[model samples]
Structure formats: structure tokens, C-alpha cells
Target: MMDIVKNKTETSNSVWHVEHATLAEWQAVMAWAKDEGWDMGLGDANAFFEVDDQGFFIGYLGKEPVAAMSIVNYSSSFSFLGHYLVSPTYRGQGYGLKLCQSAFAHGGDRCMGLDGMPAQVDNYAKWGFAGGRNNLRMVGQVQQDYHCPDYIELVQAADIDDIVAYDKSCTGIDRSALLKHWFIGETRYGFICRTGQEVTGIVGVRQSQDGYRVGPLFANTPDLVEPLFVAALSAVPQGRQVTLDVPEKADPTLIKLAEKHGFESIFHTLRMYRGEPPKEQEHKVWCIASLELG
Candidate 1:
């Protein structure tokens, strides 16, 4: 509701206008995303809405939704851009660019992050998103034979602080609210590895539209990964495919483990930032939390 598409990017500035999203509109947009093979998590819209109610938006062409996007500000200096979608019937009409510009404005001076698909890299770059790194999407049936290490335990509600700090160390984003809510649903399974009383690692998997996704897989060393991976895999419903978005350059072990467990290569996205990049503890981040949120 801040402003309409009057920035001159649109062919018909009067026709298309972006407004803050309602939860119902967000749900409808998420459904479109699922049908388009994006495999959105079932509760993603609700979680995202709770994180920043004003972050999501819809582009309306005379009351009909034609585009959608989110610019969730996690803190004073960090924001994430995602779920940018334009209706096929509305694409090529400049609605996407208009919507994107709105997101850019909403994010303001925050250092923004996005996992841009191949098709959108140039578009994102046009707006100054730079320092692209690949986030590989690996899929297959990983081994379930590994036992949970004696030091590992299911993530309890009281463990949120440790998990949030651990997650921030690797990603450089203080996503405490999102991380806490991530484990609330029944489809979510998370675990933490410990050394004595100290938390050393964390991993979680959640069911998406198509399958389960393993993410925020952070650890101090390679020795702690597989056992947690196996523990996460145990929580998914039977017969569902497994996916791990690998930051190959950041952590080489993920790809090797994926291959060892029969995972095959899929597509990848470029992790790009629109301002000064974050000082992430990349070596510890085996997989990221989400493309849409990171």
C-alpha cells in the first residue's frame, strides 16, 4: 500500500500495482509455487508471514493477483529476498521488474541476500546483487544406516538459543524467530550434536511439497555430519525423496556424502547479495536453510 507501480518500469503503470499481502493471498501464491515445482514447504507462508507481516506483497492488475514477492528484514542490517513470482499471463509486461523494484525499496539499506535462478541472475545483477556463489541442489536416496551418535539429541524447545546462535555463526543472519518456528510443525525434524555440554552442530529436515529437504546443516567438523544427516533422514515419511542444497565450495564434504549415498546432481542457484556481503563462517555451513529465505 506504500505506492503503486508508478516508477516507470511498467508499460502501463496505471494497470499494475503492488500491495502488502494478506495471509490468504500468500497461501494462494504458495500454492502456485508448489504447482510450478518449486516444492515450497507446507507451512512456509505462515512462518514467513509471522516473521514480518509487511514483508510479503502481491501485484494486482485491477484486483486480480498477477505477481508476488517477499523482502523479509531479519535485523537492522540483514534482509532476505525471495518468492518473487509473476503470473505467466502477466510476465513480459514489466510487472516482475516493478515488483522487484518494490522489494528493493522495501529492503532499504539492508544487505540483502537471494538465491537467484539462472534465468534471473542477470536481472538481479542489474539491481546490484553481486558476488554470486553456487548453492547446489542434490537429490537422491541417502544412506540411513548410520546411527545417531551418543552425543546427539533431538532438538528440544529449550535449545532454541543454541540453535539460533549456531545458525547465525554459519549464515551471518540473526534469524532467531524463523529458526525457532522452523521446528514447530510435525513434519519438521531437527537435532543437535554436543561435545560434553557444548553444542557442536545442528541439522534439520522438513517436508516440502515434493519431498523432504535437509538444511542448516552446520558442524564443527566432518565427523559430526553424517550421523546427524542420518538422524534427520529418519524423521521423514517413507518413500519421499530427499534433497540437500549443497554449498559445495563452502563445504566439500556435502557433495561427497551426497554421492556416497546415491544422490544425483540437480540444478543450482547463485547466492547473491545486493550490498556489502556478510562475513559468514562458510566452512561450517554444509547446507543452507532455504533458497527463499537465505
Candidate 2:
């Protein structure tokens, strides 16, 4: 186990140093993350590092990594703080609070946001986060005899720009590079719905411990979103389970459809903020990519 208590014998400077994570450090971080009950995939680790804009860090009590966090300078629009963790042995110390302050400092002026756990809202409030909207983490399965949705198309690398534009309408912030890394570069199945010459909706499915997840599922309406969901589930193995993160305020039709297919809440989060609340999207945001990334 990790020896994390502060050494009473040593009186060195309060050097809770932090460093940018290297690819070699990923496995250690991933292992530590999962051990702390954080659900993460190997591919997710790779994509976060490759995006270049996301900053990953490990904190040291001396020479070992006892804490970790990441910052996604999503775009000029907004930034996100996630993957925040403290080694089991290190809990109750000031490490978590320090790491969080560091993340926001690193993210700087880019309208930072994070999905704070309900019980921890007070903790985040001390750091400037306030409750805003809520999102439900839902799951379901693909029909055994699935029919392809006519408007849904298999996305080509060339279609990334169009997809990014469509994503912005649903998520007030534009994380284009992060989305590209997630849907195209990572081990995931992605589909999009187009209206004439323009792409209007998109959904991505990736393998998960429970089954498959349609994360970052963004669309313009119930009509456009339904087809994308069908396409995502059809790509998964037969009878495979699936999940999606649907916002509570999305179209009632979308909510019923997920319920019709057996999707229910695995968890819920109060999407909070510290500063002035950001504008909520007017378009349909049926699912979020992942709690870790948001």
C-alpha cells in the first residue's frame, strides 16, 4: 500500500509539488483511479493525453503519486475539471482540496465547469461551484432485430468538422478536439444524423464494464436523435447492454424512448458552477460523453 501520512519527523518545505503526466505515468494513474472506484477505460486514458489541450497531473507527498486530476481547456468557450482523485491512504488530508484549487488555477479564465457530487456540493461551494442543472445517467439495450435509421450515417473522418458544429448547438461549450479524440481516435462506434447538406445530430458508443454506453449523444430533436440511438445500438454485439447520459430537460419523447428500451438511472449529478451559471443549451442534449470527462 501507499504510505501517505505526512511525516512528522521531516520538516521540509510544504512541497506538495504537482507535475504534468507523461504517457508512461498513465497506467499507474489508471490503476490508482480504478482502485478508488472511478470507472475509467484504457482508451479513455489514451485519448485524454493525446488531445494536447487537456492537462493531467499527479501530486507527490515526496516521491510518490498520492493524488491526481486533469484539466480540459475545452476550447476558447469553456474548460472542464475532472478525473479528480486522492489515493485511499491520502484521504482526509488537505490533498484533495489543494488538487482542486490547482486544477481551477490551471484552467484559468476559460469558464470552467464540473459535475459535483450532491453530497460534495458544499465542498465545491467553498471553491466557487454552485448548483445549476441536473443530468441522469441512463442505460438500455439495442433491439435484437434492430432496423437501421435512414438518416443516421456512419461517420467518416472527413465528417468531424460538421459533427463538431452540431455538438456546439447542444453543449454551449465547443470541445471539438476532445470530441474528435473520443469518437474517432478512441475505441468507440460513432454515428451521425444529417439534414440535407448539414449534420444535425451525433452519438458515440463504446464498450464499458456493464455493457456499451452511448455517451456524448447530441442531437437537435427527438426525431433526429431516435435514429442516431438506433444506429449506435445496432453497432453493438447482439443482446449487448447499453447506457446513455440523458439530461432531465430533454424532449419527453426522448425520455420515454429510453424508458421503453429499459434505460434507467444508474446515478445522478447536479451540474454545478461557482461563478455565474453558464447558459443552458436550447437544443437537445440527450446524453453526455462521460462523467469523468465532463
Q: Report the number of the highest-TM-score candidate.
A: 1
Tens digits of lDDT, candidate 2, 1-294 = 222224322316445766677767756778876675445543776666655533777777667777888777666546677777788887888788766655566667667678756666788777777665677767666657666687677788888888777776667666676667567644577888777897778888887655677777777767776777778778788777776666677356667878887777777776776555456574567778877666
Model 1 lDDT tens row, 1-294:
455446423334445667888787688788778866677776767777767888888887766788889999888898889988888887887778877767677788999889988899889888888977888888876444445666778888888898888787787777887887786567887889888777889998888888888887898888887888777877765567887788869457878877887887789888999888778988888888788887
List candidate 1 segments past 4 Å from native: 1-14, 142-147
- Report lDDT per candidate: 0.80, 0.69
TM-score of 2: 0.85
Which residue runs does candidate 2 get wrong by more than 4 Å?
1-15, 35-38, 141-145, 276-280
Candidate 1 TM-score over all chains jointly: 0.92
